[model samples]
Target: MKTIRQVSMLQFTLMVSAFQISVAFLSLPRELARQAGTDGWIAIFFGWGMATLASAALVKVMKNNPDGTILDLLQRYMGVWASKIAAFIFTAYYLLLAYDGFMIATLVIKLWLLPSTYIYVLVLLLLIPTFQIAQHGFQAIGRYSEIVTLLSIWIPFVYLSTLRHAHWLYLLPVIKEGWLPVLSTIKIMVYPMLGIGLVFFLYPYLVRKDKALRAMVISNTLTCLVYLGITLVCYVYFSPDEIAEYNEPVISIMKSIEFQFIERVEVLFIAFYLFVFSCIWIPSMHLVSMNSAWLLGKGPERGHLALWCFAVAVSFFIYRPSFIDAARVNNFLNLAGFVMEFALPACLLLYVAIIRKVRGEKRS
Candidate 1:
């Protein structure tokens, strides 16, 4: 019997959007401020364009072989050895992405909400839910992402509240330093936009295969709007000089919002973010396991999922990394993502086009 492809286009799009809006979104305002000052929000548009182009290229690559994942394409067009290497690289990339999400969530939780909680305990807590979601495969992950996206709709509205005190003048003097800084900040926009790479594995599972590109574009558009809206709110709410001072200006600005019932909304906001943040590691862990299994020529076994969870937990325990270490890992992960997510698809598309043309000519 053939494996049924159960993920629908809507679920696939939500999964992509959820993956893009990750732990990085929390600190995005600060990074933008440091890189582009008040004009930082403009960079998101340029980032959106870049992300769209990359997604288009990725879509074309998948279109050439709609039934196969990247691993299958690589093995067919490249070779078994090359495909194995690609699989290994993908597994590592997904593992690092998962680890970064896990570490950042743990650190954020420990620092803001649970100061006394042991790191191992937090790691295991995070892993349990992730393992549960990932073991069920793409259908479950897509459904979970759709549910999380629907439930978390209130988050952006909460951010909208901070605009009451917004100083629109702060956004004035736009491009005060010319366009170079704003353009340069486009690079900083990449990490937060990294999650769209989920399409590499998910394209084969999409129910409406022809609409995959449209779904990806919609996903990137949603992500761009969210990032742009929040960054603009931050820019106007906080002074040019003050915005860069906070580690996470998006969360920090929430302190100004006052309500009768809730005393510390930011605390609750941070805690609830755990749900949004889980979207990252959960899908990421599944990607890691899926790619690793493909690398080993194995079926989708739940045993592989359990083993990876144990490995991740042991790695965290062995190192017991601090916030600084997590920051370093984030940096490395961003660099790897540029190559794996952004560059690799474009390269594959070029290779596939050329090879197909040559083969067609020989047949003629």
Candidate 2:
């Protein structure tokens, strides 16, 4: 095993926070509106609560086995064969997640910015840096995440400030329909919270210091606030019907803006979003590399193999002749993600807790 140093808790928190806001800010508002009607933001809050609890449970599991990956701890508690099965399932989930991220980015690029270019080329261009960063190990990834966390804060403020032209009446009659739709929207809203799973793969690397849980909770709370703010702005600025009509509500919201200096805000938004995507892509690539290294028992250098494999596979899978097919794959991956990221962690935590209690009773 490669000797991985523990990183600052601050870095860990920032990475988690940045990852949470990036993907959700892009497509979530429109998706939520589709599922929950006008009360989509309500479902967002509900999902936020659910995600927080999930995050806490994940952290607790990490605490129980400090300096251990979920795979490592599972083996300790659930026997080697069972742990191998669980690890395989979890790895498959993350691979799908990585594919979804790549597909979403490719779709956005093809749809809005670069209609003439090939998608595989774009995926390769992005993946090169992602692979390089992951090879630098956890510290580099943490530092990069800290820098992007600042950008994450600034991007939203820029978007929201431009929203002076927004129409608040679009958000009126909150829940014009019954609450059932809002409840149903919970599943839709929860998809973006997949970033919480980053902690499972990264937590063992965090330098545990005073109040580690506090730092993690604060990070989660700030991330939830950012998501809520973005979702609320999208709801209030564009009517539910308008949001449903647009494929990318954030881009559409930006397009609606015009300044004396700038003719098209979408271009500016895309430039910033590309940066955000890069930040997210790096850490995800790093996770894939780290996991692959552990699985293959080839030391840290093996991370490079995983990185290239992911980059190439993702590029091929996403850059299909039919962009529609790529999108269908992305949606199915997101649905699978909800189970892998949220449901699996919850189950693992419960299993560990029950095992601990049973062992304690046997000891007594």
Candidate 3:
């Protein structure tokens, strides 16, 4: 299993898009509206474009290294001890990301479906599948992302039902608030676009490395479309002034949907969204386990991974985060993630480019 072959580009896209779509489903529209009014979607596309450039830099780094993970590069550039320390830091980072997935899912589930349920139970449910999928390594996780994406494909079509009350006038005069607000919200947009950094670790497993850029662009485009469509639908359906009142704008849109047979479809949607949410954490757990395994100078350890997943989940419930606290934590994560997503990639690519140039000169 440690020596498994590379995944197809389609699987690659699904995996990447799945992570991008996860936590954003709940509060993204609301955050955008709060920050930039209807212009929030614009910032989403802009940040996505920026994320694409950052992603391309990462792909360039991977191509130069070829046959290696970031750890292998660290080993080359620094030494074995330094690489081990870097792997440990990355393991902690992946765990932090995994924790965010669990936190976001728990918060949304608690808000939408079971306000009274114990947070511990929700955390347990979220972590169980994370450990199960992370234990199987990337092969099972890739298939799971693709399969879950197929199953959840109908959700966007379901969102269209809310457009019956859509007021196109709400989106009129798109920049009613001025460009400053929209520019400020680009930071918020970068939050949903956070998954691009995972490509550093994922690129080595690509079946067609040359198609890596296309896979990334397509995946980012798909995620941008999803965010754009939902935000557009939300902007039209609710008055601009009232949109900020709802915390989870995308999920709230489902409230208007009442079928003759189905009383509250949003409940069903929120329940099934756990699958969408899983993509964020499962890959995160894999990264954590794989990085830790590398730190130990071995392959992934499912048992240790399982323990770390549970620890992350359990810590949240033990502390019992309030909604405001969660938001604060997310703000910190957003800042950290923005640096990792763009700045780190730009620096790494430059480093790799210089190293390769120096090596060529030595060979000449």
Instruction: For residues 16-72, write the lDDT of model 2, one tens digit per residue.
Output: 777666655777778888888667888767876787787777777777777778778
Candidate 1 lDDT tens digits, 245-286 = 988787788788888999999899888888889989998888
Each candidate: RMSD: 1.8, 2.8, 2.0
lDDT of 3 at 247: 81
After superposition, the stretches of candidate 1 with alpha carbons farther than 4 Å from their true spots are 361-364
Q: Give lDDT tens digits, candidate 3, residues 1-364.
A: 2476677888889898889888876788899989888877789878788989988888887776667887887788768998899789888777877777787788888888899987778888777777877787776788998899899989988988888888998888978889999999888877788888878788788889899999999999999988888989999998988989998878778889988988999999989998999998899988888888888875448767876876876687678766787688678778888787778878877776787687773311
- As a whole number from 0 to 100, the lDDT of residue 322 in candidate 1 is 83
lDDT score, candidate 2, position 227: 69
> Which candidate, 1 or 3, has the higher lDDT?
1
Give Cα distance to truth, residue 76, candidate 2, Å: 0.9
Each prediction's whole-model lDDT (CA) = 0.86, 0.71, 0.83
- What ordering of candidates by lDDT runs from best to worst? 1, 3, 2
> Of models 2 and 3, which has the larger lDDT?
3
Where model 2 places Cα greater than 4 Å from the true spot, the runs are 299-307, 310-323, 361-364
